[model samples]
Target: MLDLLVIVILLSLVVMTNRRLAYANETIHAKWLEQNLNRLLAYHTAFSFLFPLLPGDASGYWGFTLQQVTVHSNNMFDYFGLGTPFLLFLDFIPVKVMGLSFLTGNIMYGLLGFCGLRYLFLLYYKSLNLDILVFGVRTVPFLFYLPNLNFWTAGVGKDTLCFFGIACFVYGIQFYRRRIISMALAAALVYFIRPHVAFMMGASLAICVVFSGRMKAIYKILFLALVAAGAAVVYKQVLGYLRIEDLSTKSLSGVASDTAGLLEQGLTGSAVDIQSYPLPLKFFTYLFRPLFFDVHNVLTLVSSFENLAYLVILIKALPNLRRRDIGAMPMWMRTGLLIFLFAMVVFSSSLGNLGIIMRMKNMTMIYLLMYCTWSISRRKAELAARATLTHN
Candidate 1:
């Protein structure tokens, strides 16, 4: 009854917000943006309710375990890291303290993920001219409508929190000086949830800051010093959490070996045999596999369609990867690209299950999607500008 009541209230709020935005809109584009947001939020809420019935970790582990966890439980930290316990503790508040059902907890987390998605939407809407169409379609809106993005994020797990963290970090990167607290909070959220990803984000930020030609030399040095100091503070802890001996090439090779061994142990039907593939092949498979050739169920079929779109975007954006074109990209896009590449390389070497791959990649795929979309749009705008100059 309470869950239903809360859902009613949330839906009402969504309607109210949409009506307000629609009334303030003077053009069709603004109206469409509001409508898209309203639809996205509604889908997110619906998925939050539907995901708990699906046969996956959210339903199997998180839904059950978080409900069972109590404030007095000593086993919160029984896992290897603090990530699980932190999430458990978070869900415990609404579930155990305020006596909400696990379903309600899922809704709350879904709303949090919605906040992250909104931040991402605003980031792109502000940075890129989303009014520009690609292939006669508004591509930015389509990116948000991908089922996997909402499915993985609108649940009770690390994916939701990590997505939120990554979104906050990326959105804050646009105006880092003004949004330092947001970036810091995002880093901390990701550090507790997934330390290696936090490190990757920090590394990506450092690379972007160092190579950004627009920033002053003094600002570059200051940012580099800050990144170096942060890395120094967390390097050992992240390595320890990951159980990696060191950052040597040999140690990195062991990651692939370990992943191979894990895959060979009673793997399920959705496991991909990428253990024998080369590094480049592994990366490609991670980002663009489980296509039509690998579809086994309705879920995979839907995912294949989404992957097909990503492949199309990649092809469209390939020309923009040239040195000159890349150099023209904004710092945030470059940072996001680096982070996406770093994460893809690392996780592709480590994971073998298709289901897990889909969920894990959601954290970094948004960046790639945004970058590719923006590059394509920017190229179109440039071409239009050139044509105008030629005519004038």
Candidate 2:
């Protein structure tokens, strides 16, 4: 317990130190926005307490969730990846030592989230190794304080670890570029938590390698072949994790038919049958669904606003799209965007529920936003250059 408390205190201090640095580095509005985001994170943590207890709850209190975690920790490997069990034990420390409940644990997780995001920024800066900032000033804080990202990742669940894992993987990619040791660890961590997400990240990394331009053509082909082989090796395991049964027996049309049937069954009548839809519609549903028209509750309404923001961001990025040549863009930027689009297509095509899609896409949305921000920044620089030339 003392050790856990000490660790928590250390995390708090890290956040405090970084908080000062953020205020110094960011604009007043950005700092204010961050503070409000912190508050919203707290509010969301508090709000989660109101969620109804899971079934078979004997403990009229917070122990129900923890108890389940304890009971299921040992069997976690049988179902999810080893990551779930790992997080369960890690989360259990506070509860066992300090007698903390789910809500309190979530608060601590939120704090950890701040620390993780702070470290991610640090890693990003280190990778850039630049004195002069090249990206938009608002981009860093905006991604850090992204509402849904914080909301979902702040909880004491697999999502939190998954978020951390992605941050770790990205950090590893940025700093350790040639050495994938760190990235492998991050991937392994997330593989335990969510294998499908890990697979997507793996696919994205492969895409990055293809775009890197550092590798010879033969090596690129070889690398892609290896990635395909790896995917083949793990494909069945991923399908099993996804609970997609009998896929081997199904053709593409058969799979689509099954998906349509599942969507029709729906979750509280909230599912959409995207299997019958075209690619564009599927992408729209995945990226921009739960719009104002789809808002049936407070949560969806809040999400609708976020969706609207995505729409606005997409529109802003569209004009600058022509300015970007995929092959000419920096490897990391193009890779991140490709990963996001690939993941979006994968999710939007098969996913049935808006809420689930929103939550799941949290993994890739940061990369998507990063690409959009870069496009916007490039456009601004181009305009500035043009204005100077015009004056001359």
Candidate 3:
């Protein structure tokens, strides 16, 4: 009964929010946005309700956490490295104390993930002209409908929270002066959930602030100082979480090799043997594998199609990927690109399982997609301007 009531409330909120956004933004197609939102809501709700019944981490996270909470165990800090216990404790509250069903708790977290996706949509909508079609379809809307983006994030686990945190960080970076609090909160959320990712975000922000010509020198200096101070406070703790003594190249390489070996050990069905592959191949497998050749199930088939679309976008944009074009991008976009590259470098070297790759890469795929789509649009506009000048 409570689940049904919450679903109704969620539907109501979605309709109200969709109407408000459509009314305010004349460029947005009301029907199209509403359809997308409704589909997204359905995907999230369904995945939340069904994932725990499957054989994987979803069941472990939900079942084990509930058991711990019900038994009044204080061992929540045992798996602090992956932030598993933290998420488990979060699951405990609504399920044990508030007496909500697992489905309800999952739906609630799914809603938070939904908010993150919405933030990502708005970021692209404002940053780029989404109406611009790529390959005969509007790319931004189409990208939102990708199944993996919705699936991995619409569950009760680290992926959902981390996705939300990254979304908040990227969106907030666009209007950092006004959205300072949001960015700060995003960093904190990710810090507690995935400190290494938060560290990468901070590093990216620092780089952007230093190189950005739009900000005044005073502001640049202020942010640099803040970044340095924050790094000082958290550097040791993050290293501890990562279980590394230092950030030396040798240490990082060893860590990546060890991680890849561990993940590849028992996961034969889904594992791709990339440990001995070259660096470029590792990155490619991380970002764009499970293509048609690797499809073994319905999920991988959908991901293959999505990845093919992304590949098309990349190929179309490559010729126009000039330094001048990149230089003209907004600070937030550049920061996102940096973060995406950092994550690819870090994870590609360490991940060996395609299933885990799909889930983990969800955090940064939006930035890559946005960058590609924006590049294509910008080049088209430039070509149009050139043609007009030639005509004159």
Candidate 4:
């Protein structure tokens, strides 16, 4: 009886929010997609919240494990200790109490992505004079249809962590420029959730800031260094709990072995095997491949052109920059982009993880950077044309 009340309440809430939802080009959130993604998030969040923390050594035997960082001060978070890890807090929480697991994580992820989009649009608005707000407003359709984000972040997975990480990094750039304490705190939350991405994002922003010809290069390096230190601390704590012996040092090539084993089990189609692959890879393959997402090859390439979009837009906008007309750019806009670029260079490590999550590492910044730059440039053009018209 109570279940019915919950459903009715949820439905009414959705109806209320529906009118306010951004609907680019008149596309609506598909029902099947929403429910399926919600289920995935709920399952994981429930699991994360309830599961007890195992001793570091104990996690090594199975697919779920964390390396306890031996080199660390007394720390509050143990989630970093994991190598081939599991969700720390979110995984145990909702799963045990409500049998929720991945679904809750996914929901959080979606909200984070939405927040990221909003932040990026705001930055784009400040950077250039384009219709990015409109473009961003229209981006709703793409985000709604973005199944990978909808399903993964919408559930109890690292994708949402990634979403949060990327979004907060943008805020960090803002803080770095304004010298705000809240921005650093905001980034700390993301690193707490997903340490790997912390460095990746920090580096990228350093590059963006330095190259935009506005920020002091020294501050960019220092800012990135601080974030790196924070990430190392988080990694040390997490590994101290889980037991990651080495990253630059060699471990087993067990990555391929682990993946094969997962596939082997998945082939059985057990009741526990609700979906196909475990996360990291599951989300990537589904997003980039033809068999799953089912878009035309050209459209697929275009849609998947997350990071590459910047190269295209930069080519179109460099002439404008050369003319010394980079209007509305705060000194930090350049810093943010520089850091994002540098992260792609020095920190991203999914390449060696047997291609598991390799593709996702830097992709978050790609779309964010692309749309923001493109919109900013277009807005600048609008302002320029308007000024000329006024003079006439």
Candidate 1 stretches greater than 4 Å from native = 5-32, 59-81, 129-136, 247-267
Q: Could you tell me the lDDT of residue 205 within candidate 4? A: 58
> Please, what are the lDDT tens digits per residue for candidate 2 over residues 128-185?
2122222333554454555676666655666566767777676666555564677777
**Worst window of 10 by summed lDDT in candidate 1:** 60-69
**Each model's C-alpha lDDT?**
0.75, 0.60, 0.75, 0.42
Give the TM-score of each candidate. Answer: 0.85, 0.71, 0.88, 0.51
Model 3 deviation from native, Cα RMSD in Å: 3.3
TM-score of 1: 0.85
- Candidate 4 or 2, higher TM-score: 2
Better of 1 and 4 by TM-score: 1
Instruction: Please give the distance, in angstroms, between residue 358's alpha carbon in candidate 1 and its true position after superposition.
Output: 1.0
Query: Of the pair 2 and 4, which is ahead by lDDT?
Result: 2
Give one clash count per candidate, in the order shown: 0, 1, 0, 83
Highest TM-score against the true fold, candidate: 3
Per-residue lDDT tens digits for candidate 4, residues 43-124, read 4334233322312121222212333323322222443334323345434433333443232333434454545544544444
Worst 10 residues of 2 by lDDT: 53-62
